[model samples]
Target: MTRVLITGATGQVGRELVEVFADLEVTALDRAHLDVTHRDDVLDVVRRLRPHVVVNAAAWTDVDGCESDPERAHRVNAESVRWLTEATREVGGHLCHISTDYVFDGTARRPYREDDATNPRSVYGRSKLAGELELDPSATLVRTSWVFGRYGSNVVGTVLRLLDAGAPLRFVDDQVGCPTEAYDLALTIRGLVDARHAGPVHVTNDEPMSWFGFVQRVAAAAGGDPEQVEPIQTADLVPPRPAPRPPYSVLDGSLLHSLDTTAPGDLDRAIERVVAAMRSTVKR
Candidate 1:
């Protein structure tokens, strides 16, 4: 039996990972059980569990918060990953670290390749990129974008809530990226772990869309009026954020194809699934 350990178990991706790896001897830990910022606690847990695989799903994801508190972001995103990597190395366990498409500057005319230069504009992206660099040969880094799922707060949920409240929705049209489903991303990670594939990989849905388009799709799926969702350029939504976001951050997962890996669903199907899941939850 392969023993697998996951941090940020209560998060969107981590929650999905627990469900996907349910058959395995999986130990899921949330912030309370495993505070990644505490090096001693991280090392002690890894030494005791001695898992064959460690999936790090915890991250400082608040884009604006990272800009205000860069030190905390570094502690959570970079330093904690280093500690986890060291612990995993000591235990002879392979690490799977989650990353983001924000690593790229989004200036590419097409999707970003694995080897493309990363010039992250935000503190969150920089910290995540730093974590990726720290892992090197010992870990597999999976970069994804526009993540949404049933387990936690995501774009889909926010859009639905706004629609329900009859609040006018305004989404940025300038930004574009693959809207990845957390469940699909989690399953892809499971495949990599099971197959023992190494190195960095990009896993996202087949298509890319602007934030406005995504909201339109979500609204349509939820039986809401798509026209009510307004599309606006990022520039109009100022006071401007503390950190800069990439205008285009789509990641190409062609490398995963060589490894015989396939993304689960496309954007349309992912939206349908999210809508169905949300409806089911509401009915319950």
Candidate 2:
């Protein structure tokens, strides 16, 4: 069995990755077991276990929190990857790192390819890009966007909650990007790992839509009123967000053509599956 170690096992993607790689000799660790930010601990764990692969899903994903504390952001997102790279080197293991679309400034007219120049606009984006820089060319970097799943926090649950509560729904129509289900993303990752794919590759639905569009789809999939979602602009946000978001951060799987990988499953069907799964566990 191929030895695989997964970090941040409690996260949405991390959880799905655990399930997807279940057939392997998998060891999943949550933040409690392994804090990637601590260099010595990271080195010790990788050296001790000596897994063939280290899938790093651990990241300080608090975008607003990152803006407030750039130091912690750099440590968790950027510096952590640096340490992981070193540790993986010692073990001679393949490092498969999850990345985000925020690496780009989101201004391009076309979809973002793997080789496009990056101009991260926020602390989170900058830190993530820094993490990407820490990797060797042979390491696998998977970039995705607008991810939702059955676990943890996501827009799918948020939309369902508001719909269930009969609250007014409003979302921005200005920001456009692709939505990726965590389950499908894991499948894509599994393929990449098996192929020993190197360099950056985007994993997302081919088409892009506005945030308002995504919310409507989620509502429809959850048996709620899709039309109930009120479309608004970024400027219409009452308090405004702390971090700068890309207006058009849709990632195109152009590199997928060259690689032995496929994009995630259909967007609508994936949303329906997640919505159904989430509904089953709803508080009675």
Go through the candidates in order and give each one's C-alpha lDDT.
0.90, 0.93
**Candidate 2 lDDT tens digits, 1-284:** 89999999999999999999999999999999999999999999999999999999999998878999999999999999999999998889999999999999999999999999999999999999999999988899999998899999999889888998999999999999999999999999999988889989999976699999999988988888888899999998989999989999999887875676756878999999999999998954
Model 1, 1-284: lDDT tens per residue?
99999999999999999999999999999999999989999999999999999999999888899999999999999999999999999999999999999899989999999899999988999999888988958478898898999878889999988998999999999999989899988988998877767778889985788999989999998999999989999998967778888999988979877787546667777788888998799789
Error of 2 at 221 (Å): 0.9
Best by lDDT: 2
RMSD to the native, candidate 1?
Answer: 1.2
lDDT of prediction 2: 0.93
In angstroms, the error of model 1 at 150 is 0.8
